[model samples]
Target: MSPMGIRLSPLGIGVFCLLGLGVLYHVYSGFLTWRFSFLLGSRTGDTVDLRELLAVSVKAAELGGVEVKAVRESNKLNENSKGKTREGADEKLTRGDLLSNKKMANLITSSFPGVQVNTEEHLSEEDKEAVYWNRGIPNEIKEIVKNPKFVSSESITIWIDPLDATHEYTENLVNYVTTMVCVAVNGKPIIGVIHKPFTGYTAWAMVDGGSNAKTRASYNDKTPTIIVSRSHSGAVKDVTRRSFGNQTKILSAGGSGYKVLSLLDVTGNDQETADVYIHDTYIKKWDICAGNAILSALGGHMTNLKGEDIIYTGSDGNEGGLLASIGMDHDALVEKLSSKITSK
Candidate 1:
C-alpha cells in the first residue's frame, strides 16, 4: 500500500486529465453551437427590422459589382411612377430580343464593365446560362426554380443573388440592376430587401403585425393604386382590370423589389391602400425574396394565384405563380382571381 491513499499510475492520471479536458471542450462547443443556432433560427411572430434587412440587400448587391448610384437612380425612377402606363406601347420583345438588343446590351455593358453576354433564344436558356456564369446563383437556386413545394407554403425563406451577372457587369450596365431577396411567412411577406448597386439605392421592409402592411414612407389615399412590373408583360394589368375594374389606378415599376417597395408608401400617405399584386408570369425566387421579407414583416401576404402559401428553403424551389396583396382580403382576392386565370 504505497501511502495507503488513492494512488494512480502516471498513465492513468494522464488519461483522466485528458478525459476531463475533452469534456470541457465539448461543453464549450455545445454552448457556442446553441448560441449560433438561436441567432440564425427563424422565429415566428417576431418583428423584423427593416434597416437591417436593407443592409443585407446592399451587401448582396455590392457582391455583384452593381454601382450604388444606379440603384439609387432606379429607385427614384420607380418612385416617380404615378399614373404611368405599366406596359410600353411597343410590341413585346421576345426573350432573344430582350437579351440581345443592342441598346440594352450597350446599357448593360456600360454600367458593368467586366460582364460577358451569352445570348439565348429561350428564357430557360438564359436562366441556365446565368446560373452557370454567376456562382452566386448556385445549383440550389436552379433546384428551387424547378421545384414547386418551396413556394406553396405560408411561411418561407428565399435567397437571391439580386445581380447574378457580375461578370456581365462590365459588358452590360443594366445587367447590374438590383434584384429582390425575400422571405415570406404564413403566406405573408415578412422580410424583403432590394439591392441596386448601380444606383446606390437599397430598400427593405419588415412587417410588424399591422393590419395594413404598406410602409409609412409611400402611402397615399387619393389613388386607388396598383403596382406592376415595368420590364415584364402587361398581362397583369389585364388581369387586374378584369378583377378590380378600371377604377383602380395601376403603376408600372421595374424589378420585383421596387414594385413591392412602392407599395410601402415611401413618399405617399400611410393611410392609403397600397395593394401590390404580382402576376409573376415569369417569376424567379431570387427576384422576389427580399421583397417578400419586407411585406411579410409588415403583415401582408404573398402567395401564388391558387391561394396556396409559397415556401422557400426546400429541395425544389418553385412557386407556381406569385400573387401578393396587402390586408385581410388577400385570401379572398386570390380565391376570386384563381377562378379566372388559367396560369394559376
Candidate 2:
C-alpha cells in the first residue's frame, strides 16, 4: 500500500520467512543425499558409467560381427589390396570391412554422442549415420561386477577393429578373424570386447570389473608356448628360440585378436592355445587394445617388447612390438626376449 504494492503485515512477513527457510532446508537435504550417493559409487558427477559403455560396446561388436559373417556367407568379398605390409604380407580390405565398420560406428555414436572413436576401416560420409539400438544391459554382464561405475579419469577413447585379420578372412581362415572394441580412459585401456563372427564367441572384460575369459588348463610356463604371426613371422621364431630354447613350442597364427583370445583359452573353430603371444612389428592400437584390456583384467600383462606399457592416445600405430603373457612371470619373460625380438 505504501509504494503501489500490497503491504504485508508483521505476522504475514514472518510466515513468509518461515516458508523460505523450509524450502532452503529441503534443497540442502537433497544436495547432501546426492553427495552421499556419489561417494558410494552410485552417482558419478563427471565420470562416465563404464558398465553402460561396456554394454553398448558389446552390442556394437556383435552388430559388426553380423555384417562380417553375412558378407562372408554371401561370398561377395569385393576385395581390394591396401598395398603390402612392411613384412611383405598382402594387406587387404573388403566390402565386409566397410559395412561392419559403419554399423559399429553408428551404434556407438548414437549411444555416446561426443565420444572419440577410432576405427580401422575408412568410411565414406554416407556411412556415418547415428543409429540407436533400443536394448537394455546384457544379462551376461548385468551383475558381473560389484561396482560397475568407472570413477577413474573421464577422458574416454574408443578403439574399434571392425574386421580384424581381413587378409586371413579373405583366405577363408575364419578362425583367425574377430571384431574388437576397446574403451580407454586417459590413455589406459579399461574395457575390452572381442567377438568372433564365425564361431559366435565373445569375450569381454573391464578392469577392476570381472571378465568371462576362462583360464587355460594347459598353461605351461617352464616351457611356455608362444604364438607368432604367420604372415609376419620376422625373427619372432628366432627370438623365441633364443629366449625359451629350441623346444619352446612356438605356434604361428594370424590376427592379433585371435592370438589374444587364444591366451584366454578361447579355442575357436580350431583348437588353438598359447601361454604367450608375441609380435615383432609395427601394429595398430585397434588390433591389440581389446586384448590388452582383457589380459589386464585377468591379472595378465601386455606391454611393449622393451618392458614398457603402451599408452593408447588415439595414435595410428605402435612400433614398440608386442609382448603379452598370462600366468607366466611377465617381467622375466620381457627381460629374456626384449633384447632378442625387436622391430626391424
Candidate 3:
C-alpha cells in the first residue's frame, strides 16, 4: 500500500506520463492548424479584405496603361496578326499588348503571391527585362472603400487585359483603347479597373467596396441606342433591329471594354452615349470581366443573351453572346435579344 493508493512501477508511471504528453501535443497541434487555416481565409470564406485586392488591381492596371502608352508613343507598335478569328477576321496583336501584359502580370503576381493572374498575351524573352511600374494605389480608391470587409482568396483569379482594343489602337483609334484588370473569385467578378492610357482616365469598382463611376439615366426613348463591335456589327445589327424594331440606334465601336464604359457615360472620345452594349458572337472573358464587375457594382447587369451570369473562372471565352446594360431592366433586354441573337 503506497500511501493508501495502488502501487505502480517506475516504468508504468513513465509510460503514463508519456501518453499524457502525446495527447497534449496532438491537441495543441490541432489548435494551431485551425488557427492557421482561419488566418489564411480557408476556414471562413470572408477573411480576405477586398480593398487590398482592389488597391493592387488598380496599381497593376495603371502600370499596364503606362506600358501601352509608352509603346504607342515610341512609334514601335509592331502590329502582327495572331490569326483569323472564328468569324474569319484578322486578330491583331502589338508590341504594346505584350509589354503591357508583362507589366500587369508581374506586378499582380509579385504583390500577392497567392493570387492567380490570367493575361491575354504571351510573353517572350524580351518581356523578361521589361521595366516594372513601381507605384502605389491612387488616393481616390483608398478613400472610396473605408469600411473593412473580407473575401476568400482561395479561388481568386485576376483577369488582366493588358491592352483592350488592339485593333483600334493600331488603326489610331486610341480613345477606344484601355488596360483592364478584373478580380474574380470563384467565377464571379467582384473588382474591376479600366484604365485609359490615351486619356489618362481610370474607372474602378469593387462589388461592395465602392466605385468612382456612376450609372447614367435610364433610356426612356422608345427606340434605345445599342452599341456593337466595329468588326462584329453585321450580325448584332440585324438581330438588334429585329428585336427592338428597325429604329434602334446602333453604334459600332471597337474594344468590348470601351463599349461597356460607354454605357456608364465614361467615354474617352466624348461620343454619343449608348443605352446598351450587345455582342452577337463569342467574346473573351478578359474583355468583359472588368466591365461586368463595374456594372454589377453599380446595380447594373452583364450577362449572356440568355440572361445567365457570365462565368470567369475556367473558360477563356463567353460563347452565348453578350447583353450588358445599366440604369434599365436587364432581364427585359435579355428577353428581347435572347431568342433573336445568333452566335457564330
Candidate 4:
C-alpha cells in the first residue's frame, strides 16, 4: 500500500519513469518545432514588412498541426504585368504585425547586449518591442539570455536574415523561403539555425556538438552534384561547365541559405545528398552567413573562389565567388575552377 494506491515493484516504477521522460521529450520537441515554424510561417507575405501574425494564413498549409490559409494574390495587380505599387502601404500603427529584419535585429541585441550583431537593417527601439510582443523570439535564445554559461564562447557575434530567398518568395516558390540565424565566436561560426516556414522543417547544429539525423552527408554516386541559383545562372553555368565538364551534375535552387543546407539534406540518404555548392554571382553577407555557419557546424567547408575564407562581417559586402562542400576536397575543386574563372 503506497499512500492510497497499490504498491508497484521497483522495476515497474523505473520503467514508468523512463516512459514518462520519453513522452515529455517528444512533447517538447514537437512544441519547439511548431512554435518556431509557426513564427516563420506567420510572417511570410508577398510584400515587405507590416504583417499581423494570427492563427491566420492566406495560403492553405498545415504547420506544426495548425491549419494555415493558402497565400492568395492581392488582386490589385495581375500576373501579366510586372508592377509594384507602394503608394499607400504605410503601417506605422500596425508595425507590430510585421516581422521586419529590423525587429529581429533589435531583439537579438536586447537578448545579448554584450554580443555584437550584424544585420541588414538599422533597428530602433520600437522594432524591439514589436518582436517581443509578437512572439517572434525563440526559447533557446531566451535561455541564452538567462544563462551565458550555456555557450562556451566568452564573446559571440550574431548574423541574422529575417527572410532569405525573397525572389522565390515573390515568384510564389513558397517552399524555398527560409528564416536564418547564425552565431559565431572569434569570427568563426559555432551555431546555425534554419527554419523553413512552409515546409515546417527546422534544423540547427553546433560545432563539435553531438551528431543528429542531419549531421552527416555522403556521396556514393559516380556523378557529383552541385547546387547553384535557380534564377541567376550564366557566368556560373558556363564557367563551371567548362571547369567540371560533364563529370558533375548541376542543380538550380532559390536561396543561398537553403542551398548550403542542401549539402546536408539527408533525403538522398547520407550517400546521395549534394556534394558541392558554388556561386559566381554577387552574394550579400546576410544571404549565406547562416547557411555557412550551419555547414561549418556540420563539419563542412566554405571559402572564396581563390580558396580563401570569406570573413563574416554582417553589414558589409563580400568579394569574389564562393565554394562550399560537405566533406569534399575544397582546395582541389578550387584549383580546377581557378583555371576557368578569374577571382574577383
Instruction: Tell me the whole-model lDDT of each prediction, alpha carbons only.
Output: 0.47, 0.86, 0.83, 0.56
lDDT of 2 by residue, 1-344 (tens): 67978899999999999999999999999999986544322335556578878888999999999999999999999999888888876789998998999999888876675567888887678778868755467778987865667544348889999999898899888989999999998889999999999988999999989888876766787888899998888888988899899878999898999999878776544648888999888999999999999999989999999879999895769998999998889999898987777676
TM-score of 2: 0.85
Candidate topping TM-score: 2
> Which candidate ranks first by lDDT, i.e. highest?
2
User: Order of candidates by lDDT, top first?
Assistant: 2, 3, 4, 1
TM-score of candidate 3 relative to the true fold? 0.83
Q: Which run of 10 residues does model 1 get worst, by summed lDDT?
A: 129-138
What are the C-alpha RMSDs, in order, of all predicted structures?
12.8, 6.2, 6.6, 15.4
lDDT of 4 by residue, 1-344 (tens): 67869888999999999999999999999999878545443322221111111111101111211211122123121223223212222111111112335545655444344456766545656656422233342454333333222433234566766556655655556566666666666667666666666656666655555223254436532356888877655478778778777666887887776687678764532122467788875566667766676677667788888888777654455667788887777778888888788544
What TM-score do all the candidates reach, one by one? 0.49, 0.85, 0.83, 0.63
lDDT (tens digit, per residue) of candidate 3 on 44-123:
44345577778778888888899889999898999999998888889999999988898888777655556777889875
User: How many clashes does the backbone of model 1 have?
Assistant: 80
Best first by TM-score, ranked: 2, 3, 4, 1
Candidate achieving higher lDDT, 2 or 3:
2
RMSD of 4: 15.4
